[model samples]
Target: MPVNPPQAPTLSGDLLTIHRLLQSPTQIQRRLQTIQDLRFVADKILTARYRSSGGAVLYDVSEPIFNTREVESVAPGAEYPKDVTPEGAAALAAVSKWGQATQLTDERIKRNARPGDELDRVLRKVVNTIIRKVDSITISAVASAVTATSPAVDNWDVSTANILRDIETAEAAIEDLDMGYNPDSILMSSTKYAFMASDDKIATLRRRETTDNPIYGGDIEMLGNLKVIVAPASRLPSNDVWVFDSTQLGGMADEAEVDPGYTVGEMAVQIQSERIARRDAWEVWGRRITVPVIQEPGAAVKITGTNP
Candidate 1:
């Protein structure tokens, strides 16, 4: 006997059937992946990931302050370790609800007449808008928590600007803190990153070292050992850059509860859909209830005045 593979169910008939198909586990998982793919920088910078277990309006976050104490050696049979209790403070982080909604009309669905095409289109737009909002919130929180320092002389955009020296100085500042954290990554505006990549000194070095590669080819993925993260200007200021240790920087927390009709998807994002009988449309909604918390401020340094 020959067995046939099952076919994907189509969205042809009633609103109930279409809604059920859209809310299927497979389709929901696909949508969740789209959200994660869009959040490149936010996921990188926010190293610590957490989820809220209860339905709480404010998320509680606690960060331990590392004590700078050395372990003392003692004679045999003596208590060498000092009696020191771990110290930390807990603070309430306000979790903001971010969401976007889109509708799939009967006319549009009928006109397309394809299985899940119209629904996918609506989900894509709604998911993108929600991700952008979440990214903006995360970036703004980091900017506010860290202090900015202006370059002493020329900015990176200038031909004479010593970009390497500036970056080294920033790294030194973090190392001097002796907080056991060294800057491992940098975040900057795309425009500034482009300028740095095409800078005269960088190009000369790359061209001289790797002659086979084109002069204008390849992105500035790393400055020495520091990883570079290029972000949109709308999220980060064009003239600003951040040098930080991702391990000690901070974390992000999201709501974990999944409502009756809602699905708790990847990165703790919740999504729901409703059928509007009056309008003969399906309204799709996606939301993220989360907050970004800065645990160690000294682990990050912001370099400003990168351009005119």
Candidate 2:
């Protein structure tokens, strides 16, 4: 009788089921998309594809004119011409890594959800970080926007304040542009939003009075024509605020779908060294991309104050 060869050890228990999670690469992508949707800033801006090195181009044309001109000496009104402008921008990507060989330890695999849960949290952190980065770009865009500062609501720490008065002033800034873009978003820091939320005017109201109004109850309140947002303080300073139309000025450019998918193999085989056993390692990696741009400068303006 011939001697039999030895067989390599294999994974068991919940690790067996985990292959189901790793096998489906699209699942990771779906989770990453969910992360993007949860991020306030990411969900609000434009998304475009990334061109290699030279960045990508966008086209812009002057607004259309209304046909309200009377003919003079058989001459038609100023004719609109075929005019288009090409603008270019670039996208940047950030990558994050998680997981380790210990996650695949024999006893650990019995309660495999532990490792899986840890990986999920790590991925969420990565995606959230990317969203914050994108928000910074938006803040920069509004930093130098047309002025609409008002002392009445200028300082958040001020003893006497009025959110409505400040908002009215900000809306005037957008309308003053006459760009036809409406102020649809009210973006602020969490700190600033908290100030508004706890204010006597918003926080204290009769139930019957607020039966038709939701802003009176929530920290993130809304006006008739504007949606209030309490963004992260790290991303947007509490000292400044903005009212703008995302469709007209804000864009997320192009972003690649994240691939938080993983692969299982041996440390020695993958790294080309006597690292460890064949099933000693696992890794979670993914990519996030974005090119946030301000298309219409006049569409968004910084309100509030610039005091020390």
The numbered model that scores best in TM-score is 1
lDDT of 1 by residue, 1-96 (tens): 544663434555554555676657556666566544555467688787766555333333334345446667788999777656555555667677
Structural RMSD, model 1: 7.6
Model 1, C-alpha of 145: deviation from truth (Å): 1.3
What TM-scores do the predictions have? Answer: 0.81, 0.65
Clashes of 2: 3
Q: What is candidate 2's lDDT per residue for 215-263, written digit by digit as tens?
A: 5543344664778776777776446777777667645444233233332
Least well predicted 10-residue stretch by lDDT in candidate 1: 55-64
lDDT of 2 at 102: 21
Off by over 4 Å in 1: 1-20, 23-25, 31-37, 53-73, 113-117, 148-153, 207-217
Q: Cα lDDT of all candidates, in order? A: 0.71, 0.50
In candidate 1, how many Å is residue 15 off? 12
